[model samples]
Target chain A: MRISWITEDKHTPSVVEYGKVSGEYSEKARGEHTSYQYFLYSSGKIHHVKIGPLHPATTYFYRCGRSGPEFSFKTPPSQFPLQFVVLGDLGQTEWTASTLKHVNSSDYDVFLLPGDLSYADTHQPLWDSFGRLVEPYASQRPWMVTEGNHEIESFPTSYPDSFIAFNARWPMPFQQSGSTSNLYYSFEVSGAHILMLGSYTDFHAQSDQYKWLQADLANVDRTTTPWLIALLHAPWYNTNTAHQGEGEAMRLAMEKLLYDARVDLVFAGHVHAYERFTRIYDNKADSCGPMYITIGDGGNREGLALTFQSPASPLSLYREPSFGHGRLRIENETHAQWSWHRNNDSDAFEADNVWIHSLRSSKECWNHTQDSSLDVHDEF
Target chain B: MRISWITEDKHTPSVVEYGKVSGEYSEKARGEHTSYQYFLYSSGKIHHVKIGPLHPATTYFYRCGRSGPEFSFKTPPSQFPLQFVVLGDLGQTEWTASTLKHVNSSDYDVFLLPGDLSYADTHQPLWDSFGRLVEPYASQRPWMVTEGNHEIESFPTSYPDSFIAFNARWPMPFQQSGSTSNLYYSFEVSGAHILMLGSYTDFHAQSDQYKWLQADLANVDRTTTPWLIALLHAPWYNTNTAHQGEGEAMRLAMEKLLYDARVDLVFAGHVHAYERFTRIYDNKADSCGPMYITIGDGGNREGLALTFQSPASPLSLYREPSFGHGRLRIENETHAQWSWHRNNDSDAFEADNVWIHSLRSSKECWNHTQDSSLDVHDEF
Candidate 1:
């Protein structure tokens, strides 16, 4: 259902026009206390009308004078450089606040939880706790999210429905996905194409997601949109022992497809650690492969994964299990800087940095000239 | 700053023993992956160990294995009940997917928002948009919020914060009163005491908030550990034309003596829409007022202040401007039936139909008859 707002003039007493189209009015009778009206349309559309202009930086929920069902929405000002703080594996624990504080300082457009949000078995109260913690931010900016392992605690029933609870409180683009599910979907932010993938679902070859992924990736044109980033629950080339091979399986299933399409970057969580890999392909370090980043340090109960297990091959670049969050600055299409913030048991601290240069020219690794096939020794 | 995650197992490889009597431990240089560690002492003091559990959920800016400085953290698990979902003035725009979908499915403990949630500003994303939108069952649970004039925009910054940019990414206790500020502070959930009052700061008077607010409220009985709650954007009892007696002209300046008490709920959102009052005293609503509900319909771009001008003495049994948000069940408080959910243009649906008997019996409004002084008159 669709909902809209209307305003009233001080000099004139008139019913605010909720919709420009005919036949858009509230179905529920109006009450003196009820200054607004709700309406439901024949097409299941909903609308809301107010007495006048509303306050800025506030949240609202309404239906158009009973013309349709009720819906909720928040209002934000028009501005640029909409800040979006992106991270994953943010368990509902005390540490989550630190990361939130840092992100909150910036004028971000949204808070993106790529996946692995709350830890496993987080019940309603836990969810409430998380809500309150992030309320300071979500109440202001849109708290956008994707599915993660922790969100899938209960199988079919609770897991899928849990998202419904999240959606009810916040609004998202669940309909964007071809499948009638919130699991996987796509949305646009200015000039960026954000593809949210679901790893818990069937991501194997011939799977619906595989086909969708291919189509979505192929549809992107470098002209209008030069940045293409994909978010999932697990990482493809993590070296942490806790979730070492967890995403390798999924990577094998979709890496080539993503690589062939030249996807720009990929973000994932799950392993309770932080890891960033150099661009690589098929178990080998290649400049063309998407840069893989794992930011699963969102504060949760489970401790961070600390051991790094180098692959039999030399694809792994760096790995750590410190609890923290990552920040990415998409400076144009060719230049991006990524940083990680660690929670040092006291207050949050800054820990790592990486400068990403697009591969528009040279196709070789500027930092490495060693045998590409040599096996790197396993080190923790 | 950039930070990386490192596990304890990678550093010490062996556990160290510390005397239980003393809260001190010997520190040794750790290996590559493990750098910092923590341990709890019998005296309740915490110390750092060569390889021990680091402070959980704190933010640390440290480097990994002699790398550069980066920021990172350990996120808490996505659990139920205590989790929170926060947002502000996030209209149902094209870029709202990430915030909506993410908060929807992920588990949260609680949902807390200061103000200006729905874009009641333009009425484009209405209440129905909120009701039918899915994030899992948060609709059926608790969704708590304060105020933003977007709930009542036409009135001016009559609401609070005058539509300043809200920070939804972080969760902080809105503490401090003598220091009046829009979107003010203080509150609590479970074991935590929170402070959330700040909307209209520049003014002062012998107002309710001014006559009773205090910092000692944080020193509650640890044995009982009843959470403290405090919130206000425009000081619900203010008196202004645009706001019309809203917030009662800064109550904090006069209410600094009530800090030594315990408060459970404190909520506020400008007249634009809705809010729930807490049961505390001073700016702290009492058990008599554990909850101070105010639905500001942040969604209303056009403000709605029909009641303020209405001869109705008591501000609102319930009022709507056309857009707003509500605070659902807080942590498992001992008292009060689950409060009702309030929105802008829709019939108040029982978002969660649970009875907060504990809260109800302990509060002042328990058996009090509905105040008839304020005539709620509207034609349906």
Candidate 2:
């Protein structure tokens, strides 16, 4: 696992000393530090330390620098019965703290965020604040994230590059999954293959994202990785008035690919609301299609998007504008449970819950072998 | 394998379609593109396409971009009988072409270059020329390299960062080996574990490079990877008068770790001459010490270091001022052949040839197990 943090002093070495026991670090690893340019925001060096070849489902205690305080983390299991907490649009706000508190109460394996992490926008120093805000939980488990609209901190002539801060601070293992850009990448954990796609980046037919997605989907082996899930910022099947039609172009360019791959779940977060849809493809219900859901309720300063269009379609099973987080518990190879919790409720209110079956085991989808897709790409 | 190239047009998709046969690209992959900063020199786009999970010891025919020419490369084998060509200080000169021609005549699995690649030296356009000049050889085989003094294209204030072009163009699998910086990394190929150390980077006991090297060396399982080799610029042991004492500090900080690990050989450059040393540690001959060799005679624009200090030490086995390359042919697990070839020789002149026995098989040194080092780090 890779552990990254920042320090004011560049002379301090980037090192992580870790072991299986608390306060007793047996293993040490070192990483490189890089600094980026931000207008009206100059700061210290950012340290990234990658330590690995670790055991699955193991807890490790670590210290960042020589004199820094110690921290601990548990590696994700290699088998089923794994739980992943999904939080989105998580800005540094009071509600975000509540959401985190609610999340911390549960024992989960991984943290997945669609995007809009810091909500810092162009204020680069807030990135440091955001890092500190989530360091407690983020240091304990792997937090996989993607880019959102707000992450595009592009300026006129001074700072033309977008996502410079986001990319630098939140570097992903895109290269491991054959992704050229950290904006979009995939990871397989606990018999599940989760794809973090870049909604803000290019998604045209000839775009690098589209081509990579095609190749990545074609390369999945459903037999081993039974659960196929995807996450992006903009919801393709959102009914909320906020950010409507934002994902239309992306859906038009890549919906067929997902549908054909029989991806079990497609989670998105851009609407700042919660909405669940039936197994749908191209705005219509399809038996083999993915269960699309938008859970952008993790609290940010921008408040709740409480307005939904009147007369929701039949495909829209549930829709709500509330501050909450979701969890996907993969119980076994065939069955999994997905539930969302509202933060305001005194009790853990499971406002929406559903049982999902793996599309790999479904007779309707299992027959569509990966070879057919491979053949299309002329890949062996 | 990752294939990178430049396109004159930004619209051109960075795609590599590949297969096992000629003109039959069955598998297709897409990569990301980026534009970098140069004073006055500007290019369209640099595309880096990574296509992998490929079978080892197999031939792969690939085409980069949409309309680029077809190229082929053979992946290094997983077993013994692997050959690695060692060339250093290889600038784009006629001597470099001659050295390349001499190298191309024989087949090698991997190319180990210890820095000073293009010698563009801040004239960024020369980077393009160097890339084009070596494309035929580089595209066919993996050219693993590190940074050199010449690679530091740092200008006082305008371009303060060093190795911007080198880092962008020649991205290595440093992360794969748990390395945070591309400047230093280790890769296990065939039956050998090769460490590419950065000579220009910080190498103090408290530096990240030192910590990383310690951890990396301790993690190596000599039982699996029997042959342990290392490469770096600035020869630790040199009799050449051109660049003396350049590698003294680095050698002081790192020599003990390599010695304790029983490294079989260490290849270095930067002296602009060919010099080979006997098994030596500290300043004396040790049975378990690495046989350090300087092969900086890779035909750089800077002429050869014609002068060798009089009264050569007994440790310095061979020294010569000529443009040539060296090859290490690991014939088997227990034996290997090291030979240097002179560029002007009509025949493949094995000017300096020696047979090396694996240190792992030596009863004198192999007894110092990895556990002893791991115990020091408290690693499991």
**In terms of DockQ, which candidate is strongest?**
1
Residue runs of model 2 more than 4 Å from their true location after superposition:
A1-380, B369-371, B377-380
Q: Tens-digit lDDT track for model 2 on A237-318?
A: 8888666666776788888888888889999997788899999987789888999999899998766878788898899999
User: How far off is residue A66 in model 2, in Å?
Assistant: 59
Q: What local distance difference test score does each model get? A: 0.46, 0.86
Q: What is the lDDT of residue B97 in candidate 2?
A: 96
Docking class of 2: incorrect
Clashing pairs in 2: A26-B378, A378-B26
